[model samples]
Target: MKYNEIKNYLNGKFVSGMGEKYDVYAPINGEIIGEFKAATKAQLDEVVAKAKAAQESWAGLTAKSRSKVIYKYRELLMKYREELSVVNCEENGKSMEEAYAGVDKAIELTEFACSIPQLISGKTQDVSKGVNCKEERRPLGVVASITPFNFPVMVPHWTVPNAIALGNAIILKPSELTPISAMKMAELWEEAGLPEGIFNVVNGGKEIVEGICDNKDIVAVSFVGSTPVAEIVHKRGSANSKRVLALGGAKNHIVVMPDANKDAGSRDIISSAFGMSGQRCMAVSVMIGVGSIDEVYGEVVAKAKNMVPGVDLPPVISEAAIKKIEDYLDYAQENGAEIVVDGRKVKTDEGYFIGPSIIDWGNSKKMSSEEIFGPVLEIRSANTIAEAAAIQNESPYGNAAAIFTQNGRFVDEAIREFQAGMLGVNIGVPVPREPFSFGGIKDSKFGYGDITGVSSIDFWTNLIKITTKWNPEHKVDWMS
Candidate 1:
């Protein structure tokens, strides 16, 4: 596909923008790959109107019919999995393997959406004599999905497939940094015979987001990004009387207990911290060494040192991200933290690269608690499991936490007390499969309803109860 061919899709057709176009560069080589036109306000309004018009017909279709279309979409996605991965790698700078994983995850969610017929079934009950009440789930007219640059394909799939399966028309505002992959997805949905305006891709930044949030036609909004931006989306969308599910940032921690296997636990920690260059929301940003600071620190640092930059590792999202990671490393050094393995020294003439970095905070609480969103791991020590749990719980972002302990009792306690939406006992990254809700608590998330699985179906639809009482009227003949 050429650069000019990458335009926004609206109402079942490729629409060229008369507005200003933004240049998109391949992060791998710093080459200009394409340009995307920003959708004007008028264009956005027109698409929303078309989507509102199409949503009624889409909802009118039987669940099985919707499932068939979703299945077809799954087929097309699988067929173009490699192509999509290539586009994702070029745009996002993740390794090919990670890109492939993103594509597979997207396909998995689409497959899950195909089973919406069974998932969306409501309930019935008899409330009183000759009266019965039944709950019905109906589609919200229009939904808008605002996804982040990282995991462009997977994050959008988190909401889009499920929303559409429940018969809601979607206006997708993918991260402007990685819009090509989403454009391809829209094209694939069109090829799968999805109705026009059922899925529209608009390319822009905050302006487009404001349009989606403030638009009365959009009944619901789904967003995944930084906590600050997530709060904005949630507040603005809710203020507009729209249902919002805003998944925010995470400061995930991995607690390595004294009884944990040193070698295996260290390897898992390295993988969790450096995978995708630590751009993932569930990535281990903090390692709480419980009662084994020296032992855990040595092993983790050794493993991290052997991680080769730009080969076993990948670059951060862009030049700006690389600078941000560097700034964080500088802060760590200034705060009396030992820079065990500095990734900023990696040699990359073209791409925005940063290898895995480790910082030993020497049991001090002076380290920054912000979500760095890079391959920088901070090591903190806790005297006991309770102290470690407190450190993990006190963070404002309660997205995910993991404990590497063989002791079943500790595992049980951690499961009970850890303040996170997702918990991993031995697993480093415990992201659930398709049929599960993926979200966090506290400042990590805003609004009700998660992105995927049953929560998605619930978010994209409204519930109503119907009560019926039928009485035979033989005495009505008196009126005749």
Candidate 2:
């Protein structure tokens, strides 16, 4: 693949302007593949102005018309799925299989967008004599979608498809680390018959984020990233009177009961902890074993030990991520934890490679509680299933949690007891698909609505209700 320098996609074209710039690297092999310039505040305002200008005409189209365009875009995405998957893998450093899955998931979100006409059909009711009320979904004008680098295609689709399907013009400020795939998608949107200025991509760092938050023309914001940044975006955007939904970091946990399916449960648990190199927000960080659950733990460790880097596990996103993950391993070891598998020493000569590291998490609550967005697994022991749940509940984040058990009572209890917005029973990664919605409770989510599925319709638009009384003369005082 030929690597090229990327620029801002503004007003239906790839354009560049003066601002802070950052270099983009391919983490798989440790090479500087490209550089992207941040959009200046003026450039940011220009794109927002363009979106504002386009939103009304776009919204004027019937819902079915909007859905048609979205469906076309989905088709275009599917046609180039392999190419996009390659770009995702090249830029984000996930395995080819994982990268393909990410792009496929993005396309799935677009498929969900194709059904927005039905979702926004609205409602009407006859309130009283000669009186009627109708409630309808109205587009929120210009909305900004801010995405993370982890899932190049998937994260943007979390809000973009839903927002655009609701008839809103979008300004996508993707992570500078992975701007190539986003810019490429802009081309596909144009090909799919989306109007000029209706969809735009502006790559930047902090200034562009502030631009998105503070710009009055932007009516809503969708953000996905670390907890600290998610909080900032939510507060700043809300302070500026824009609707905001921000998904943040998480330390997702899974509990293993004594009666759980030991062999199969352990394998799935290992996958949950190590898949995507454990970089996913939904990845299980801590596994709590209830009494006599050693079978599951032992099996999980056994399966994890055999993982081979660059083949079984992909590299982390950056050199800094390598150091960050290793620092955690060092800290854990120094704090009475055992490093069951030392990923700190990489066998691969090239790439930002790090194998899976398993920690016993003996006395380090810090290691178990913190969000280690890497292929690091921490294990702990608890006396009861409730005790294990209590340990998971201690986390400040509530993105997702899972339990492996045969008892219906335990599953039912976990459904009520787990604080996570997404839950799993005998499942590892329990991310909800379309129509089910995805978001978390507590610090995991900053705003009121989920970023995807049926629940997201409210976040991307506003409800407009019309009350009519053409002939309101109720002279009939006779009780019927």
Best by TM-score: 2
Instruction: Give candidate 2's TM-score.
Output: 0.97
TM-scores vs. true structure, each candidate: 0.96, 0.97
Candidate 2 residue-wise lDDT, 1-480, digit = tens: 365668788878889757887888888898888887788999989888987888889999998988888999999999999999999998999888998899889988998999989878889987766677999998989999999989988998888888888999999998888898898889899899998888899888898899999999998999999999999999999999999999999999898889999877988898899898988899999988777787888888788778889889988888888888888988887888888888876546788888888888753465646688999988888777677778888999999999999999989887778889999988899999888899999889999978899999988878999988765566543321
Off by over 4 Å in 1: 293-296, 472-480
Clashes of 2: 0
Question: Which runs in model 2 stand beyond 4 Å of their true positions?
Answer: 362-368, 475-480
lDDT per residue as tens, model 1, 275-317: 9989999999999888855666788888778887678888778
- Each model's lDDT comes to 0.87, 0.87
